[model samples]
Target: MTRIPTLFFATAALFALIGMAWGIQMSASQDHALSPAHGHLNLIGFVAMAVFGGYYALNPLAAASRLAMVHYALTLAAVIVLVPGIVMALRGTGEALAKGGSVLALLSMALFLVAVLRHARGLMR
Candidate 1:
């Protein structure tokens, strides 16, 4: 129950709530782009963060890596960037923030996976 997934879930939920509010208030708009934003936020932020955090928690060796700190930091940064990036896109900003956030998140996840694999290999030796 570290703060990462918790915060991610909460933030994603908030976005979902906002989207729902928009739907309820603006039924005549005919386009619900916010739902897609909410979907991405929940999928990437909540689900992925939970899975990553759970993996690290269950694998003590993985948690002990030097990359663990980097992983967590990058994850937090990605969430920070991602939420705003999603919202900004909903508000009609360019796609740069979303692209940057997605890249950071993907790279961070890849690094964490490498660390996990290395730790698992070490355990086999």
Candidate 2:
């Protein structure tokens, strides 16, 4: 019921819609050129966010922490940067955004890991 989980879940739903629409558009156009971006959108944007949301839902302690907000922001920023970066890369443009986004995504995951570990330790104690 925490805000973190709700935010994540809502964002995940939005990403799912976008990803599905993109998939359908690609299929109709018979253009699989953006397949990589499509896959990332579904996997990272939808699946990963859903999983993160579920985790926070189950672990309210972590979800309530300040770090949770940081994690969410970083993940969101990564997705924002990454999707466009992938599209640009597909068009043979620069990759700076893609690289930066990838790093931000990794950092977000690392923050989640830390939160998990801390929560687990608290539960054990």
Candidate 3:
């Protein structure tokens, strides 16, 4: 359980650094335009992953069962779709992968929220 948090924090920090580097490069390149990659890295990689990890750490039981696979799957799904979607979106490709990726990301968040809430309620009793 703690490992989940540790991994999450580490992953988030890595993405944050990458995002900052991308930002610095953009700034130095005379292009103030926003790259979807920046948002994806920050939101999906750093923020979302950290939240999922926190939830898992706080509720170890959630990670002990098959549902753990679901959690990991959803997060991976988000990353899979999100990363490519960001690159495509930034390139002005109006495909539906980005939209679909967003939906998957939302689904992942919902899964995490439900799991955390259920765990919290279990603790209260």
Candidate 4:
């Protein structure tokens, strides 16, 4: 409904498309080795983002804050890095990317908690 929610939904849709494509590719090739990474991409990228968007749409105050934008950025970074990072880790590459992305994801969720406490409180009234 609002700008932030719209952005989030758009991002979620994109991630869903990517995840679906990856899934189809895997199925066609009969190689499920990267399924875990694919699952994370859909869960964190699509589902988490859509849930955030819904929350923001319902709580405009939370969506309006600068912290909301920060949350979105952190989430975007997490999905972007984490998927590839997991792939690398599974392939026996260095784990720096996965670790960094995991931290980013944690920070994103932490900021989201702050948003709920700080801005979404009005919903309780």
Candidate 5:
């Protein structure tokens, strides 16, 4: 119920909508070239974020922590950077944005790991 979890869930839903739209467009056009981007949007953006939100919802203490905010911000940044980066790469430009976004996404996941390790025990009871 905390803000972090709410944000994650909302973002996840948004990503799901986008991914679905992308998939529909690809299907309609019969051009599956952007399949990778679409996959990432669904898997990382929707699924991963939904899981993160679920975890934070179950562990309110972690959700309430400052680290949760950092994780949320980094995750959001990763999605923002990654989506455009992938688009650019698909357009034959470069992978800089994708790489940077990947790093940020990994850092966000690492932070999530830290939060789990630090607070998961409290939930065990």
Candidate 6:
């Protein structure tokens, strides 16, 4: 019943591990140029996703809905693209992916708000 929550945690853990490794790598190389990207990876990919999972676990009614899955997908996509986007932008590649990923992140937050609002409505029933 908590498939989404479990998925979120699993993905978050992976992101956290990657972020940690990235941090260590940067430290070893004495290059903090990509710290911004690493920070986002940990904050968005690990912390935010883990928080989303906790929220879903607390509100299974919302978790059971399609919106939850969509939220997961969108959030995951945001993390996937956004981190790389930041890196590419930092490398002077382009701003396209960063812009797109920012939009996805915004949309994901909106969906999360919708889920929270809907859950509140259900609670009043």
Per-model CA lDDT versus the true structure: 0.68, 0.90, 0.74, 0.91, 0.90, 0.93
Per-residue lDDT for 123 in model 4? 80
Q: After TM-score superposition, what is the CA distance of residue 105 in candidate 6 from its true location, in Å? A: 0.7
Off by over 4 Å in 3: none
Q: What is the C-alpha RMSD of each candidate to the true structure, in Å?
A: 4.1, 0.9, 2.2, 0.8, 1.0, 1.0
- Residues 1-125, model 2: lDDT tens digits: 99999999999999999999999999999999999888888877888889999999999999999999888898899899888888888898988888888898899889888988989987787
Query: What is candidate 6's lDDT per residue for 7-104, written digit by digit as tens?
Result: 99999999999999999999999999989889989998999899999999988999999999999999999999999999999999998888988899
* Candidate 1 weakest ten by summed lDDT: 1-10
TM-score of 5: 0.95
* Number of backbone collisions per candidate: 0, 0, 0, 0, 0, 0
Candidate 4 residue spans exceeding 4 A from truth: none
> What is the C-alpha lDDT profile of model 1 across 12-110, one tens digit per residue?
465456546665655677666666565565566566766776776666667766677677778767867876787787788777887888888898789
Query: How far off is residue 70 in model 5, in Å?
Result: 0.7
Error at 12, model 5, angstroms: 0.3
TM-score of each: 0.69, 0.96, 0.80, 0.97, 0.95, 0.96
Candidate 6 off by > 4 Å: none
Better of 5 and 6 by TM-score: 6
Assess the local accuracy of residue 4 in candidate 2 as a C-alpha lDDT between 0 and 100.
97
Query: What TM-score does prediction 1 earn?
Result: 0.69
What local lDDT does model 2 show for residue 20? 96
